[model samples]
Target: MKDCEFFFESKENVEQDGRVILDEYRTHLKDKNTREDINDNELLEKCINIVFEHMKYNRVYIYGIGSSSVVAREFKLRFMRLGLDVDYLAESHSIRMNITRVNQESLVIGISVSGKTEEVIEGLREAKEKGAKTIMLSAARVYEYRSYYDELILIGGLKNLAISDKISPQVPALIVVDILYSHYLNYNNDNKKEKLQMTLEHINYELEE
Candidate 1:
């Protein structure tokens, strides 16, 4: 079944070993990836604007565990550079215990590939009960966790991709983040550029010490 899909076709001008060509399989996966991202744009933008608006008057929190937690951490790092106060918790129990702090102005993001991580789902549920805005990023189709989420972004199930894409959730997760980063950059390109420069300089100065 996997053999039937093709993301890149050999051009007449190109000649290479099949092994070398196989190494470029990422090119094929990425073509399919772009289409996957296109389907999520409307929801992604809505969620991004919601987050940006919340940041203006409130706070942003992200929760996840395992490799999905890694994605949450990356999301935090990127947005923090834009000067948003973003907090990422890779521990599920911590999020659940502390979620009482979330309110209507708070935007809570839950990142999990399976969308069934007990701790993650529980934490999101708590945030919802507290009246915070919630977003879920997962590779899984909407499931029981959907009830607790205000918005959902399905990353098109990387499992459907070739063998190379099946092992990691980070691939699709990061793709979505890259798009969100672009949205942030586009929303305030000039101001963000200046602030990013200042932040980089400050970090560098601290590191040099």
Candidate 2:
């Protein structure tokens, strides 16, 4: 048996069908989870103020590649649902051309899992130069390009598993976006209590099912 297989489980070859959804909650429970060192309230408040600041721009540009792109688009739709102008860039030139068009009143949210993706890093630099405010969503430990952003939202700790299968990374990214959605709602909506209650209901439903 391969070392990875031996290290994880025998069920992988027998029953898992080579697909595993990395159970994020289980991963967290494996360790004594700690809240991120950064102030949660401050991050949420800043994101809200930033959103309000660009309310008139009617265009929020989001750029990310691979799995990050999926997360970015999720946020775009969430914001759009809240009546904000949001766009997700899909192609290379579409993003490059739009960079010149972005204004000081616009916001560009860049998502990079590693915090070092060349395209994402370079894109944020271009957006910043165009006078658009930038926010980075990453769990990156250190990045020299950090100085260019107006806000940094850390998603919490990351875990690497030795399971010998292709587990979907997209789900975890989606969960982080959901967390960000909560922060946005907390900061902006006057009906914050109602919104929080709804979210709690959703979580409970998921747990029960």
TM-score result, candidate 1: 0.77
Model 1, C-alpha of 199: deviation from truth (Å): 0.8
Best by lDDT: 1
Considering only N, C-alpha and C atoms within 3 Å, which residue pairs clash in candidate 1? none
lDDT tens digits, residue span 24-93, model 1: 4455356665467536667878987888788787779899888888889999999888888898888856
For all candidates in order, the CA lDDT equals: 0.76, 0.67
lDDT of 1: 0.76
| Model 2, C-alpha of 97: deviation from truth (Å) | 1.8
The residue-by-residue lDDT of candidate 2 on 137-177, one tens digit each, is: 76574457866678877654445421213434444456666
